[model samples]
Target: MSSQFLVTSRRDMEERGWDQLDFVYINGDAYVDHPSFAAAVIGRVLESRGYRVGIISQPDWHSAEPFKALGRPRLAALITAGNLDSMLNEKTAAKKFRSRDNYSPGGETGRRPERATIVYANRMREAYKDVPIIIGGIEASLRRFAHYDYWSNKVRHSILLDSKADILSYGMGERSVAEIADALAEGKTTAEMYDIRGICYVTSRAPLSDKAVMCPSYEEVRDDKKAFAEAFKIQYEEQDPYHGRTIIQPSENRFVVQTPPALPLTTEEMDAIYELPFQRRWHPMYDEAGGVPALQEVQFSLTSQRGCFGHCHFCAITSHQGRIIQHRSHESLLREAKRMTELPDFKGYIHDVGGPTANFRHEACGKQRISGACRNRHCIGSEVCPNLDTSHEDYRRLLREIRQVPGVKKVFVRSGLRYDYVLADHNKKFVEELCQYHVSGQLKVAPEHVVKHVTDLMGKADAQAFLKFKEWFDEANRKLGKKQYLVPYFMSSHPGCTLRDAVELAEFLRDMHMQPEQVQDFIPTPGSLSTAMYYTGMNPLTGEKVYVARRPEEKQMQRALMQYKNPANYDIVYKALCQAGRRDLIGFGPKCLIPPRRLKGTRPEQTPQRRGSLQLPKKTRRRDTRGRK
Candidate 1:
């Protein structure tokens, strides 16, 4: 309530040692790690039950220093979230681009720690073998099964077993973290805590054999890395919950992990979660290197809601968060907004709010409450429950409230908004408001592909809907007397796209007179429905045959479609046309506007006699020029 935890000083921890610590929380990634905030919340929860607590932020879990720093105390347990290190490459030009103005005098330097949450857990295990290490967050939640790793380009098992954490909390952490802390403080042992929902833990006999007791097979998740990464990118771009079975296993050697039921938060609960104290500063390291750039300013972010009803095949939100829409209260959002406004040299705007699908206010229809997402693994042919509502009213209201907060001036919906939902609204007032107020002349919307077959395969909205939405968006901006432009996000080389599809898309771009600023190659992220199609060429849900373009040439064509303006793409486009047997498109296709080349003369025509005869042409030319002069 005080927001004092927003600024964690070393002295605060020094004053509160092992005796004051009811639980020691750990973070896998520094970006998501908010020791000060976690400590304050867990400590408050513990204190509510008459126990004291302290927090340790990104401590050297590998060394005994952290353990010694706290000394020997009534150590209740160790809590952790998904990230151990920032998954972003600190040395990347992307990072530099994101923080151009914030560039330090020395330029951006310093290596980010390994981002795998399990890495930090393993280090913690090394120091405190018997201590309970509870893991949660995106890294732990999504990886709680056999998953494909983009960084390593291989399938791996759940972080729980890999890191040897006592328990793995999946999905949203607020309730689960509190429950786990309360259970541990009551003297429940690690083995006894398995009964808690949204957690994954090993049985006592887990390590006795090489096999996992409850693991899914590794063959299930032996997906291709490229497909996995592409699907993952789509999920992030769409921000719609994907509705298909994820690869839960890779090989017989390792078992795949599945999550417990998704817990949808009510507005009240969402309010309480956001109200938790968050460290509202750019990460110290990031700041020291020069503050984060405007684009990368959201190095630390929090979502105000979860679950999406939009059943996009390329998204994992529905699978991970369910089709139910949950939200935090307006009061809670304002509180966080105020905290963000209070940062040192803080500007008025916060990065983003909302989750899964930003515009999703509730389930599609009117199902108030229901069981967690049906873990059916596929939604290809399944009927969408009528109760789910994909309306934008609630979000519109939330955004309106967020914008009016005292210190906040601009509230960007950096999260993906379901364009279908926005377009379906009978009135265009909301769209106009978004254009005039929230957007900064550039609004990002995902129209993953122009190919109808592929969009159907990926469970995305048809291209027509995107076009209609584009029209309405433009109209809305015009009505509001604004010059905002739509930056449509497109994906190339998805699971079921072919060279023809890519070519058609290229033609569409040419017709629209639009060129994309960024093009994302499909990378299959682990644990999503789309990944299965990318890997097996079959939809996991319906077992239906799906076309996948995997050849190097096909991939090149799809990629070239997004870069029509680049000269390098000329050869690529040519080869694509040739390979697709569209030789007519070689010189100047409908989409490609290059000029044709002249034909060459045969060798016989260039002999000495032919040359002498042709010499007359030169004499005629000279005579004509002399006469004219």
Candidate 2:
């Protein structure tokens, strides 16, 4: 297994009979030689082009001593904060420390430092004073522009400025990373590598291109919230690859310049990248420590595409992967499927077969490839555009082909399906087949919320779209004679979401008889329109005033409403109902969120306790919520 993996120690390099390495990848997670991990993908991509690469995972930040273990790379030091932003990985949306880090071995926590990109880059500089350090992955990509840092409670400059790395590869970095490595290897300095797309660097001179856009500087955005919102608007609209311009902003004494994103990979390129020889599992060193938790679901999965067109405000996919989808050919995917069948550990089940959005197997429309995604409009927001390609025929064909492969027991589409996108398509075969074969017990979708304002602010489809899909799903399952369900993911305390809006969503859940086990509290990560709105209190795209739930208590109340049936949320649910002046919902009626407080002098037993706290429960407790009795 160690022979199959990239060089991690001096012994591995010696075993490979190499005295020098082209690039040494520093990652925040334990070294896992899988394409699902960014560190592995970049390393393999470099290897394919005849470059030697090594791995240095989760080095100690106490000093420069640990970074030198892998020795200095001849080309440069490639660094990433693993697959997720270091802060988001370490803390929950409530700013509380997370109990576990799935990306770490044995589901460990505290393995990586806060702001890992900056910390790792600084240490690399200490280890090799003149090494050309490059930072990428979610942390550097989303923070390419000055963004509102929710954890710090202030606006911070672009990560390129803070990390002090020679170059920052912003988006999916297959192209930019290779170009950077080639330039470095060709005796070119980092200062001469500004023309690469999807890369950002700091400079002192003004932008030379007439097409470049001058956004508000760090001082302006930091001092004025309105300035911050305006700057975000420019950043959001300019994500286009075909027509996008270079973005320049002043930071302190220097400036940060970002070129337009790299174009979506061609089918051949996508196929070649995914078909790389990957171990597809955590390093064997962790075999005794229960391996990496993150690989459990993905080891048997296949990534059939890249990019997303949903463009939800809270999501940064469009910012990082762009809005135009790029997919591998069916033949390429089938090849990967065939390989999985031969693995001894494969359970004959392909856990998933999708990307950012499961059903988006192609670009949004023909125009996107030519002129790029519309400047200020979303592909599917309140209404679907007439030019939008709402066909899932290709995706359906791909799934069917996989299912027909040898030794593949079942092919499940575990990733989320844009329900609105499903409804927009006239053909119902995909959804019907999905319900019949792909789904195990449920099909999960994300409507975000039911309130029109919240959905509008979030740039998501309305509740009508979700309900229609739910109806279609239930009918399809009933006709198929299967007892399946639809799990709709809803978030709370998003920008523009108020107490009344939460109440409306709770009532909608009650009407649907849905007791959602999880409710996502909106996290204002960098590089999202929602975070801009959260920081500025105004929608950057629309210029409308937005109500942000900045208080922790308010956000908790909003989250509790969606799970009002849970005994632990009774107090918060009551507080929210009262705050919204919706006392009508606090009664013995079946539609009520919770039973009215037990009579003032009621007996202790009559007051109810633990999970069965509601005295006048309309639904029987049974053995538990699942009726396991």
TM-scores for every candidate against the unseen true structure: 0.76, 0.94
Q: Write the per-residue lDDT of candidate 2 for residues 159-227, one digit (tens) a residue.
A: 887788999998889999999988988999998888888899999997767889999999999999988
For candidate 1, what is the total of clashing residue pairs?
A: 43
The lDDT, on a scale of 0 to 1, for candidate 2 is 0.84
Write one digit per residue (lDDT tens) for candidate 1, span 302-322: 467666656676555543455
The deviation in Å at residue 7 for candidate 2 is: 0.9
Best by lDDT: 2
Model 2 alpha-carbon drift over 4 Å, by segment: 1-3, 598-629
Give candidate 1's error at residue 264 in angstroms: 2.4
Superposed by TM-score, candidate 1 places the C-alpha of residue 400 at a distance from the truth, in angstroms, of 3.5
